[model samples]
Target: MDLYITEKPSVAEALAKYFNSTGANFKKEKNCYKDTKKNIFITWAVGHLLYQNPPEAYNPEWKNWKLDTLPMIPTIFKKTPYAAKKEQYKAVISLIKDATTIINVGDPDREGQVLIDELLPANKKVKRLLLNALDETSIRKALDDIKDNKAFSGLYAAGDCRSEIDWLLGMNLTRFFSLKAREGGYTTVMSVGRVKAPTLALIVNREAEITGFKTQKYYNIFAHLKINGVTVKASFVGDRITAKSEAEKIVTASKSSELKVTDVFKKSNKQEIKELYSLDTLQIDADKYFGLSADDTLKTIQKLYESKYLSYPRSDCKYLPTSQFTDSPNLIIAFNEAQLLDVKIPLPNLRPPVFNDAKVSAHHAIVPTGKIPDLSTLSKNEKDLYLLVLKKYASIFFPVYEYESHKVILTNGKYDFTFTTKITVNSGWTALYKNMPVSDDAEHEQDNEVEISTAVKAGTAYRVETFELKDAETKPPRRYTEGSLIKAMNNIKGDTKESNNILSKIKGIGTPATRATIIKELIAGEQLSKKGKTLIPTEKGKNLIAILPEIITKADYTANMEILLDQLEAGKIPKQKIITEVTDFLNTIIKQKDSLKIVNKDFPCPTCRKGFLMIKYYKDPDTNTVIEYAKCNNAECNQITPAKNNKPKIITCPVCKKGFMISKKNSKTKNIFYACSCYPDCKTVLSEDDFNKKRG
Candidate 1:
């Protein structure tokens, strides 16, 4: 009797139906699918079957973050039994005890491998069935080729190494920073983590660029050209054009010159539709076009996958595996019949994207379950996300859009100017994306030599209807859209030298299954905010990085750690060594705290003009207490203040001879108060009129 264990019930349910296990009796609490025929029991674990606990679990004082207990290193890490859904874990346990041979069916990724590795019953006959798609065909195929769990020993090691490294680096550094901040009298929650710090660092850097940006003015020459009575506006070239006098002279000469055909050159180019929708690509498109947050996009995609309307939503590859290609056609037909196209642009074609097994590493790119969704049944967001998937699916079978590209050159006084244009020949896959506006393409159609109607020679002069000097400004870096940030995270080349090492070895920023969660964590932590789909770093996030260690803030550092972890999982390296090395590295960063100096320009201490006000504590919104406090840098000054207990207090002139006392909330309703510390001495109370008084 054989038993299959998946990661989630959603997947198990889908797989059970495909297997047509008529005698299988389903149980939710025990999370088992008992098949009477084969006498097999299948169960699943929701995410991690076990997790790492704090060092204090073994040594009590270590649980509480204390500076004296710096570099709390744990040898021979212990795992605790933890299940977010306890009932599911119970069912899994029950199934595990009864199964003869267990087949693991987690996501075919590094993390997934670790998830299953920790859950199998001790000393049991366990086989790994790595299948990316939960479809009946893929599952049945995986069952036929089930591999020994020993084959993934290296992968399991890597996952273990990654967790340990994060623990060593994150827990130690976060504690070190917190203590350093406390000693310095700044009460901010100084934190650092392998991925969290680097990710936070990205947002912080972006914020700095935006805040410090300086705009510069530039000039350019624009002209309207009339060729065969059709008008086209010329794109801006550099102002001054090196030969401004020549340009002006030519403009004067062209005002009265007869229009003539100039030399025309043409070349054909094909606009290939993007490779099928990788989870990253799909999330990106949804963010750009539909303004969906990366997290939201993943959630929506997951629902679609669970509904059997799409394949796995956590895949990184956009190409289908050669093995899965056999089932692609039927999936396409199912999608069409399901009318998934009812809400989106009509399907361009039903063919699957090109299958390149080399590119299909862990999982094939996201595609339809071949079951089109019922538009009326889905929410607005589900519909929008479905549309994106539908279009991507259709694009694979559609022919590439073909265009005739043209380059026209004009010369005046030995100064030559060139214009490029593309004339659409066939809509092809672009038909699905055509209704969308040309967001960044600024040149007008009339200015382009689209399907040039005139056969103009290069030497022939053309009349310029009008000319003007256009003013322009050097633009600062645009704020990060969820689409762009995801790209940055996935950047292989990396934006900084330190990050390059990590980028070189790592395939992408983070795994597809975890990327969305990382983004959500940042948002939840208030390190970033979503102004629509644009992720902007908040002040708190910026301050955190400004005072964090260089090692933790470097994205490449995180990437390098990830690679090492991967190596560990692959059995290329020992987990203990990686953990030890990381733990030591973090301790070194802590020892160099004198180098990091945090400055607050406006946050000044109320007691002393020389001291800056520092945030001391963090309290839950619903329950407020004296959670934390920051102190002034000057120890002699001894400037310290307690955080407001819940909501701020409003009192009448305790000291004020006139006027009233008042308190106000910040943009997010945090807290602020205005009162005289000289309550008994000066008795000066705060006044609404005085508050309303403008300050520069």
Candidate 2:
């Protein structure tokens, strides 16, 4: 008899229902069921059933902060004992005790591998069922052909290596920094991990870019042409007229001369619709269109997918396999949504869903279940997300969108004017997106709409309708918006560029499941703040990175570690090798005591209300300040004020001498209290309504 254990109760229940097993018993604490004929029981563990603990567990005094315990490397890391979990742990142990055979049914990835391997008793015999998608078909197949746990020894090694590295570095470095600071008031939670540090660095780097950007000026030449009494717009190619004199000369040259059509090049092109929404891609789209954070977007999509309104949402692949193509029609039948399932889904005679097999990683791409979404029952946000999924699925059978592209070149002797236009030959899958407008923050926001003129011969001539010099400026790199950041992390851009090549080699900074959490952590840590859809680093964040060692803050270091992790998983390198490397790296960073600097800025302290505030920058021991109230630095007559706390809080107005309170929540939550910091002299105060409407 074999007992299968899954990572979550939801998945176990799903499998049970799909099999139509009778006399199944469900318990939250035990999360198990019995298979009467075989006397086998199936159970589950919430996320990770076991985890590494603090060094203090071994030596009580080790809990205390000290430089002597700088590198606390454990020969063998301890597991979170059943004694701690008490109830669930007891249930699992009992289930294991009675079982002759155990099947590990965790997610098909590193984290899942660790969850199962770490919980097993030392001498227990176990097998692994590597199931990627939590679907009935996938689950049944895995159960029938269960592989020996030994087959996945490489995967477990990688997970073990990852855990050990995080523990050695995070535990030791956090302790090293906490004890060294003068505030001696240790940070309740000062974390440093492989992904966390580099994630924070992304924000710190962006903040520097925003602060150092300097504006520059440039110019261009423009013309408004007339065709059969209708005006058509055109511009000079490239920055052909940067200087004022050059622009004026081009404008002057176009005024009198005939706009001769020196050359006309035309070509017809076609574009295949994008495949489907992977979780990352969906999150990127939501951030651009709905201003949803990556975390929020994931949550919404997960709900929709689990509710059977969409296919699997955690997929990394954007294309489906060819094997699933024929069954696509039956999958559509399960959908209850009226938008689709009602209309005949066109099934084009295309190759199997399988394309290049190498493109698939842990799972296939996200798709619809062919279930029609009931738009009326869904929230506005849910509906919007569902529609995105539905449209992408429907587009699978769509033909390529064809267009006739024209490049009409006009030369007034030396100064040339060119007109380019695209005439649509076929709408294809674009029809699915016709009702949806382009997201406001869409990438590559080029002007797609152009006035198409009648085809011109190679040597045609026409009069110049209008001409002028248009002033412009060379803009700096755009800030890191959630959409663009996701793209960067995924390395979705083309290869050939060096920076992109570097990004491609490295696994993404965080896994798909953890990326959203990482972004949330940055915001909660106050390292990054949202400026509309863009994530800009805070002043404190910049200073934090400035003080840390270069390796601690750069993406390249994280990427290199990722390479090692891959090697560990393939059995090419031992787990201990990478774990040792990370431990050594953390120790080197902690010892760089003299390389640290902290930036302090002054503000009227919110906590004390009378003194100027001194912001503490670095977390390392060398930089700590002792200032209770936000106070003025003057020794003789120190004035202090209450320092503002984190997030939305109440504050009194300094100007107008009014005793009103202000909060930092959404505009609807703002009060009328905030005023100028000039005290009674500048008696200016704005109403809550007025301030709420003010654009930051």
Give the TM-score of each candidate.
Answer: 0.82, 0.80
Model 2: lDDT to the true structure = 0.65
Q: Model 1: per-residue lDDT, tens digit, 570-621? A: 6677777777677677677767766665554435554556876555556667
Question: How well is each residue in 479-592 modelled by candidate 2, as lDDT tens digits?
Answer: 877766776666632223543455575446666777788778767765678888888876545545665566766566656666687888787888778877877787786676
Q: What lDDT score belongs to each candidate, Candidate 1 first?
A: 0.67, 0.65
Q: TM-score for candidate 2, please give it.
A: 0.80
TM match of model 1 to true structure: 0.82
Model 1 per-residue lDDT at 277: 86
